[model samples]
Target: MSKTYDVIVVGARVAGSSLAYWLAREGYEVLLVDRGTFPSDTLSTNNLYSNSLGLLRGMGVLDALLNTNTPIYRRAHINFDGAVIDGLFPESDGITGCLCVRRKYLDQILFENAKAQPGVTAIEGFRVTALIQEDGIITCIEGKRKDGGDDIETYSARLVVGADGRLSKVREWAGSERKIAVPTDFASYAAYVTDFVQEGEMHVEFYKNQDKLAIVFPTSDDQFVVGVMYPLDDSAWMERFKSDPEEGIRRLIDEGFGHTSLADRFRKANFAETVKGMHGYDNDWFVGMGQGWALLGDALSFKDPAVGQGLHDALYGAHMLSEILSQYPASEWKRSWEPMGKVYQSAMEAKLMSRFWIGCQFTKNTPAPPEITAAYSLVGSDRQATETFLGMYNYVKEPEDLQKEIGRLLSGVNPQIPQK
Candidate 1:
């Protein structure tokens, strides 16, 4: 007989493992399965903001994360078409800062915490191929051990979750339809580097250019993550990097920063990890809930990393679903899964879809218009506006609110409203 569980989550990285951990605390019997092992690296510029840190703190995983000694970045610099904005991430409610820890370290921490729970049974190296349905309802998953042998096995669950990411197998098998999907017009390349010097060790810098955008983040273990997003259709750029990524990335760095004093600093930096990139994926949101199964994290939505929102959005997805699921404990979840799943799905769409749209727009790689740059400079000059603008990523500060505040600041001055 196949083993049974209250829930079975596929893809035990950020979203899967964290959801298992959260659900386990709610007294659910969870079977968490992943095709890969823990401490494995995945594709991400996986930075977490204050709101995500607050969620982790609430989940009791913050201290363990902090123990890894990832540097907490309090200040930031955003350069838009040569206009600079400098500010601090606001500290409130004990959520003090941001960090871009390596995914291997971060995922391992969440996975370890999850599998340790008595209510959770975590399995690694298991490739789930298909779902088993009875009377048209998904009841079990079937797959084989990735390394032990070819023998296939099965595990049953009251509900199955697809946290498997962009090309989610579970999402495919479940036939979750897309509601709003936008193809990414730009491609991203990122790497971790050593000896990448900066004035402030606690600063993250973003440089937005006409045809590309470049970002430099100070990350854990005394390393920096430098990334660039270029127009995907640019054939010359693709040809230049397709074979020798190192030379290409180095050239990109040399060119991106060549105009600034920082150019010499990056020229001396060495790679801590090889450059990795993403291409041909859509920044989209899928229907969040379905019968007998639900989607979480990148399985449900994937946005351009340009906004640095993907990691936090995944954590937020887990937290949001868990919040709704908490209302109906494991014992009663079977009866409530569909209805509450709809509620959760609707809530996810309402809360996050707008941001995904914004991320889609960012792929255009156009420089910020002059008026917007001026407004940014205005906002950056004001400490309060700057902090609140930083808080926009955390969702604590709404876009409309920021616009209003900017208007208030511009009220007294003769604002240069651009004409058609």
Candidate 2:
């Protein structure tokens, strides 16, 4: 006899763990499964903005996360060409700063929190092998031990969620079609370094030469995450980095920053971890709802990671799904879940589309437009403008509104209209 649950959430990382935690807290019988064990690392941006930090606090894991000794960054410095924009993170909604904890630590906190919930059952090292359907609606999930054990299990559920990732098996089985897909022409490489000082601020330094983008941010245990991105077409550069990542990063810092003291610091620092990265990640948004099934996190929508918004979107999307599911009883999921899921997905897309467009601009090899550069300069000088710009990431202001404000500012600075 198969054990039944009100909800079975696949992929127990940020999205799946959060969904399970919230749903189980609402008194539902939730079963969460993942192929990987807890405290395992995954390739991620690992940067958390104000919105994501607030979600972690809401989940009651903020104190534990703080105990992990992760650094809190209160400022951001973005440098493009020779123009530098320094901005203080607008402290609002009770969040004072941002964090950059590794996924191994952060996801484990979320997973353990979910498992501690009374109505949740969590299974690690188990992979979902198949979906069992009746009358064209998914009702049960089949799983096998990832370690090649003989134990196979089936569990029925009223609702199943694909909180996996971009390459989600659940999404494939659901036949969800991607509605928006855009491929980026860049690849990223990242590694951890110890004693790489940034003076308690996060820096996104871009250099026009080699079309390179570098992010230097502090994380837990006096360590920093240094990452670089370059054009995918530059195969020689990619091969060089693939062969010797540390030396490649050293060369990037020295070349991109023009041999500044920061570059010297990175060159002298000890690399705490091996470099890891991926290429050909496309921005995708799939159909999010189906009968007896729904998707969350990267499974539902994924954008270029340059903006570091994926984890934030995942946590908040799970929060929103829990809110929607709470309104209907488990028995009525078949009658009510899909319609609510559609409404939630539409709202999520609307909120994220503007930021998505902004992130796409960073994937290009060329420098930003003059008006955009003007905006960054304004952020460096004007405190109000800085807040307005950073507010886009915090969801306090819409991207369209911010663009209009920037345009107005630019018009005042450059009064003459150039005839095209």
- Provide C-alpha RMSD values for all models, in order: 3.6, 3.9
lDDT of each: 0.82, 0.81
Measured against the true structure, the TM-scores of the candidates, in listed sequence, are 0.94, 0.92
RMSD of 2: 3.9
TM-score of 2: 0.92
lDDT, candidate 2, 1-420, per-residue tens: 379999999999999999999998899999999999988998888888877888889999989988898877777766765456667667657886788898889999999999999999999998999888888888999989787687878999998999989899999998988888878778888888886665444544333333777877788788888878888888887787889978877887787776345676676788998789887688888888787788999999888777888898899889988888888777787887567877877878877777777677776666567766656676556555666777777777677666766666665653255534
Show how many residue pairs clash in every candidate, following the order shown: 0, 0
Pairs of residues clashing in candidate 2:
none
Per TM-score, the best of the predicted structures is: 1
Model 1: per-residue lDDT, tens digit, 103-207? Answer: 988999999988998899988999998998887778899987777687888999988999999899998888888887788777788888898778764688887
